[model samples]
Target chain A: MSSPARRGRPGYDQDAVLQIAVEAFNLHGYEATSMGLLAEKLGVSKSAIYHHVASKEALLELALEQALGGLEALLTEPAALEGPADSRLEHVLRGTIGVLVDKLPYVTLLLRLRGNTEMEREALRRRRDFDREVSSLVEAAQSAGSLRSDVDARIAERLLFGTINSIVEWYRPEGPLSAEELADQVIAMVFNGLHAQS
Target chain B: MSSPARRGRPGYDQDAVLQIAVEAFNLHGYEATSMGLLAEKLGVSKSAIYHHVASKEALLELALEQALGGLEALLTEPAALEGPADSRLEHVLRGTIGVLVDKLPYVTLLLRLRGNTEMEREALRRRRDFDREVSSLVEAAQSAGSLRSDVDARIAERLLFGTINSIVEWYRPEGPLSAEELADQVIAMVFNGLHAQS
Candidate 1:
């Protein structure tokens, strides 16, 4: 399938290559997928792929960056940075859900990383930093008496994001549940008890 | 390391073999772990490992059963069956936490299944059935005016258990948070929400 004509196609840019590579990585697992497999899936030669990236790990780095970059950007946005801790936390939660929905495959890949490589370890470190940032926000909300102080901030952070992260397991972009609707339901359940108010 | 003396040891049994195999499966992807690797890990010949399980798929079946059995048992427990729907749901949630904590490795394996084979397909089906059962309870609670009716019952069930299932990603038996403590925090956050009531 390594035709020069196919490799020279106008639409087969680096972004297109990355999208397909990430999908392949998510399907077969990063550790199991080889460049040959990716080349075969892309209907291109290994050289065609290498023309865009240096190695398989580069594809992973780009994918992780795509997922992490979206999340990190949320922490610094006007609403997230300027609001009351509770509101800011809410914004972050909603924003994170948006990121997960928008970059479902990339985020799914990020979540499944096992830290078997230096690149993965670095990604994990960034992820932990992101968690710590959210945990700090939770602590701020608790101190402000917006969020319940009884639950440890770290544990609260874990449960909140854990529930959010689990969406990648079952969510489909084409499914009836829109991203905004999902954010609304999650926000409602999280900020207000599910118990019917008397 | 395939010493006959090691194979003859009283401590080496099917349970022991299954335990190590599950651990290996969790560390390495299940498809990547071969029986030869399992034999090496068990310090026995392939034939000695075979004496306990017929094949690698058999080991996977046994491991999945260990995990699924724990979760399935919770559905039939009196607390899970005999209370108001919300209370019954809480009991199942707490019980699930206990099972996850007790069978962390096995459950981790079960959660990561990709359904590449019939055995995995059956396990996935059972998992869906378990999820459906929980969703029905959520629907019952909503009808009983205990759970908020606005949110979709199925979505609530997913978030509740998704948060629960995520514990395997980070919970450690030796960590400061005990299973009971973890369950309390989860139950508190899930049913009560994180917002501090004035």
Candidate 2:
């Protein structure tokens, strides 16, 4: 059985709280996890959490904001934005998947967050916006004849993200594959076909 | 606002207690959702639940067993097992996706279930078995040169299932797409390329 996650860095220590939040949210789920539980997980009182954030909702908002912001940053990266559309799309895909894997708990919590709270709703909206940016890249790639031309872009977008997002269900950082290894494998599978080479 | 997910049917005599079980299980999550709250949700006493299932774990076991049975049955069908690997794989994919969509609530709960309780672990064991069956089909498809052969069969299996598994995040049954429509779209995206032909 996997041991509980180790805490993150000490100074600028929202990282510890974020890690604990991600774990608690993932284990019990966001709706069921409470700020008090988070504080307990981090070996602190609930009031100490407030010294850093205003409310449980604020913590959630901050966590999702980081997760979404990482993805959005990938959109603006030099390699992701330039080059042939397929290569650029591939670049963005690899970068985003890498970010998701590295920040697995945070992104998992982010992806699983439904609009139960105002913070969640905002996160959901930002997620959709990220999706649209990726979709635009897919459109560009399709126009360039790199991606296949028979299926609808919207459906393709959903499948691509769906495949990428499902990584959370089975991905364990402690497993044989490192985060980078897993991301590379996903990218190779998504872009190049998975059949054995002749 | 979700129409309160009405309990019972016009003529089918749907069990109200089951509806409460499903909602509570979905909302609080099965591990955290309790008998007292379930009783409260159903507007019934806790004894009413015991009258139906032996315990909370029993309720979970029944639900997952039913859902997994539906999925396993599809995998063994002649169409899913025979034909060109792509066609058979597509048949399996479409059937599985359809089942997942038709049984969203049950399957969603099934997918999110961690091996917390004995019943949950059994459900997980069955899920792994189901995954293995599908992976065999993927392996067969690769051997037949129907699927790309560049990626490892195991990882490829993960991708195929991952893509299918992601439906939980976005699909809305009450939305415009019928289950069959969604299934077709999902199948096409995974198997047939998505770029529009010039």
Candidate 3:
């Protein structure tokens, strides 16, 4: 309700602006969203936004980095590194759902980008790298005789991520199920499926 | 490779133009890909393209209907109506993969739409209706004691579709895996999971 003229610039920092920017981009799309439109959405002057980020691409970079950094960090986590392959795979899968739900907006934006720009290409490359890393875990689990060997490791990887990534399309923040509950249900379906085992 | 001036109007009917339009929309995005660009993609003049479809929204309606119609038909199939919930669900799941691969471009464009237009809103409504119908099967399976009761039917529906829908994001028609094989692998992983049963 406060006047924009009197609004403190510090109130809208880079992270805060990036959140709004990502939401706008998600709603209006990245190509259609202009700096002027972003300013209007933020209820702040363009100069105020420019104070923190140099350009829209810079905001994109920061937003994508939040998602990429979280995923990359999962690779080095103790559960991913030191455990048996099946356990490690499960760990990473759970961690991924955690990241997807926690950083829903950033990951949603990242998934929607199609390598149109240098920044987008970089995001795609990093996403591919993440997939490869997960594939290695799937392969390892297969080799350990814990995961089914009938399916190719790469195919397994795709299905796993496919199942996980689809959440961005349908998950609502205020939906009846919590993210943890979602993760558990996904884990159950991915591990055991809907068929009631005898 | 042919000149637009020499191309006859009959060469590109509504279906052919829709195929090309969906590919263009998938590649360039629906918002950025103009009718002029569609004419360029189709090797036809703008007027020739307009002769087949009144507008881009009309083309979108046709493309989306292709996917929605296929999904809607899954409800009435003998497998969907006459069998146990597990069998019925499996039938629909396999049929869905078939439809997805068969109509990849149209479904891709449909999934990418953000409900910005009345046409897209209709598509969204139809999509929700499809989800509800599928969820009913999940609920029925749960009631039949063939599916786990611990997981909410709504959650199961999201995960099932989530796993199914992710294929559009990563599936490659020319890749080593055929659509049938992809469906099989997805089914195996979805129903049996990655864990090796002792």
Candidate 4:
């Protein structure tokens, strides 16, 4: 969980306020949503929101940080750091779906942004950086002879991440499938393919 | 090629104009772009754009038709219609990637819309219908014993498409990798899985 902003009131929390803000941005385009509108939706004074977040853009930055930060941190985790290249790659792939499911709203918003602003641009750059790191892992697995070397590592990584990110397009927390089940299916399909191997 | 509007003046094709419009809608959020802006970018009057498309919304529908229509048509193609379920599924998957590459801009816009308007909602519905059709194909392949039945058919379809749809996120027409090469890699990974088969 993110650290709360400077506490301004007895009852309200910054994380809760950010959740509402992220929802409004998700429902309404970030460019179309306003701080005033978020305050209205939160039923708090505009001053109260300002007390938590410095500005509307700040909220966007924090939301993006929340989503991308998780993935970045996953790269250094013990699971990722200590495994064979193939196992580590699997760990990151599963971790990615976990992050997507955990921070669905934030990542959805991040994916939707057009990079028209500095915050969105920074997010795009960081996203590319993350993709590059994952691509290197794919290359490593190929070198280790566990993964097929016929496909380009970069393309393989893109498809793998693409499959993972596409979850945001249709997954609903209220839906019948749990996140764990969905991730398992994804791992099986991506790592093992859909065909029944003899 | 789309039929050009009754030419008010000379020299522009409706297909060409639609391509420009799709690019604009993609670069700028669809809602944020307008007929006047499209005209200004096209170096023609708003009336000229109207000469081709009935309205802003009309162009959106046509562009959508171009993207989704390709996939809808693929369902009935000879390859999709006359093969083992596994082969038919492969044909459809490859064809889906082809359409995505061929109509990248239009599909990108369709994917990014937030369903804030009637047009977007209709597009979303059509998109869901397309997904259902593909899911049925997956089930058929599973029933045929070629594809793994352990994973839920719907989950399998989502990951399959998730990988294909993700091309819109990073594919560039001028990039070093040809669309055919990328599709080939996708097909291999998706059909055979990434792990080296014994």
* Per-residue alpha-carbon lDDT of candidate 3 for residues B58-145, written as tens digits (9 for 90 to 100): 8889999999999899989898899788889888989999999999998888777789888799899999998898889889988999
True contacts kept of 3: 0.72
lDDT of 4 by residue, B1-198 (tens): 123453244677798789888888887668778988888777777888888989888888889889888888998899999889999888888888889888888888877767778877988898889889889989999998999998999888888888998898889978898878888899889888898776
Q: Pick the candidate with the highest lDDT.
A: 1
Tell me the alpha-carbon RMSD of every candidate.
Answer: 2.4, 4.7, 2.3, 4.6
| Local distance difference test scores for all models | 0.90, 0.75, 0.86, 0.85
How does candidate 4 score on lDDT?
A: 0.85
Instruction: Please give the TM-score for the first chain of candidate 2.
Output: 0.87
TM-score of each: 0.93, 0.80, 0.92, 0.90
Residues B1-198 of candidate 2 have per-residue lDDT tens digits of: 113343222221225556557767887777678888876666555776687878887777767766798898997799986788767877887888888887787888888776877767878898888888778877888888877765566776788888888887678889887877777666655554343223
User: Candidate 3, residues A117-143: lDDT per residue as tens digits?
Assistant: 987898889999999988998899888
Please rank every candidate by lDDT, starting with the best: 1, 3, 4, 2
Evaluate model 4 with DockQ and give the value.
Answer: 0.80
Query: Which residue runs does candidate 2 get wrong by more than 4 Å?
Result: A1-12, A28-55, A143-145, A178-181, A192-198, B1-24, B31-59, B83-86, B178-181, B192-198
Tens digits of per-residue lDDT for model 2, A80-137: 8779887888777788788788788889888777798776788899999989988888
Task: List where candidate 1 sits over 4 angstroms from the true fold.
Answer: A1-8, B1-8
Model 4: pairs clashing at backbone N, Cα or C within 3 Å = none
Show the lowest summed lDDT stretch of 10 residues, model 3 chain B.
B1-10
Candidate 1 CAPRI category: medium
Tens-digit lDDT track for model 1 on B1-198?
A: 346656545457899899899988998779889999988877777888888989999999999998898999999999889979999999888988999999999999988898989989999999889889899999999999999998999999999888999999889999889999999999888888999987
In model 1, the Cα lDDT at residue A80 comes to 88
